[model samples]
Target: MITYSTVKSTLIEKGTRILKVLQFGAKTADECAPFGDDSNPIANMTAIYAETSTVDEQVIIGYINTKQLAAPGEKRLYSLKNDKSISFYVWLRNNGILELGGDDHNLVRFEPLNQGIAAANGEINTELQKIQTAIIGLGGAYTAGHISTDIDAAKINEIKCL
Candidate 1:
């Protein structure tokens, strides 16, 4: 039988990294900007909107990329992705959005593709759970702690008696 602790530990260790990436916007060219060897075109327009609470004080900014030379009245607007959800605790700690003793809240918008990414992430997590169950089964009850140490010892004594 599967125990809550076993699943909880497995989920916490294996799921955290996957969840972090799925929840936060992946570090990609689109998010980081300056696709190739080109310099940042929006450097002049970049403005720091907020600073994180972490020791490093990572800042979030608003900027306009105008290297492509858009037509008059046509300008590019950058926004966060919809599927990635930043944690309230992390946001508070990293973004400094809330004061040290203040209540945390959602200060950023979700990406447009958030639904699709979230669904995929859910499927992956479910698959991991199934895999863990199969592994424990193959390794036997002792491998998965389905039987208590006392019961295992008792079983060993019965086998020794035989």
Candidate 2:
């Protein structure tokens, strides 16, 4: 098996650059000696020794378990972050649960539903209000105002740094 190491901080493109191997001993030159001299290896390793495979001050660690599960049940998970900041963090459970955001207060759990997440808008909220009103009109002892207001576009917007 060929082990890949990064001698310095590297940048990985989203759609390009194939990174199928695990990188170990990042920023540690001694670990790269066994891999032999590299004319030009992954992450531009031209030096005789190895360096860290940090992408934008974030280290990418990958794990592979071939014998853990069947081919169809295989799963891959990744978490990228640094001491100062977090690049990306997510978890996928074996029961098909996806959790995002690292902390409990900020974390958002997405449970499986018949129809995935719906877009935030006024129409759905309006319909929901009507249903609540109808339920109350039928002498149902249920509290109302769960979805009091509709979410408008101005209240939320997509923001991407890069």
Candidate 3:
């Protein structure tokens, strides 16, 4: 979810240009601006504005390119292609808008997902649940207190769900 803080920051920094969340559907890739001698990326500009909790303007200010221009700590620009509709969270930069990471929130940003450990825990939880259920079915002494431990419970509960 987009948070109020994100909107506030964008407004403070961009002054006139505001952040917008947009959805583009069934698009085709075309040649766009070249980054260097070898990298020529494709882009699409057709999009429909998505409503935000904080901002209500429906107009899209600028075109969004498919190429991802990496900032500091990034390796290189990776161009994106759109055939089906996709949502973009963007802000104005260099006379055009650059796509921010795909956080569809219009008010507050959600914490990033930690898939590495979560995946392992989810797998363990699934197995634990199966074993617990089987023991109870066989009239064993397994009870609710024997449920999965914290190692198995610390998966996706804290992350906001769409």
Tens-digit lDDT track of model 1 for 1-162: 111110001012332211111112221111222335222222123322232455433322323332342345443322222232221221123333333223544322233235555676677667766777888779843222221112222232222211
Q: Estimate the TM-score of every prediction.
A: 0.20, 0.28, 0.20
lDDT of 1 at 130: 72
Residue pairs clashing in model 1 are: 52-94, 52-95, 53-94, 81-111, 82-110, 82-111, 82-112, 83-114
Clashing pairs in 3: 1-105, 2-105, 2-106, 2-107, 2-108, 3-107, 3-108, 4-107, 25-85
TM-score of 3: 0.20
Question: Where in model 3 is the C-alpha error above 4 Å?
Answer: 1-113, 144-162
Alpha carbon lDDT at 81, candidate 2: 36
Off by over 4 Å in 2: 1-6, 11-79, 84-87, 103-148, 154-162
**1-162 per-residue lDDT for model 2 (tens digits):** 223443353333553222322255444322221234221123333233322554333322322222232235434333333332334445554676454544355422333211233434345667777887898899886554443332243232343211
lDDT of each: 0.30, 0.38, 0.39
Candidate 3 lDDT over 88-132, as tens digits, reads 334434544343554354432233334444666678777877877
Clashing pairs in 2: 6-51, 7-51, 27-51, 27-52
State the number of backbone clashes in model 2: 4
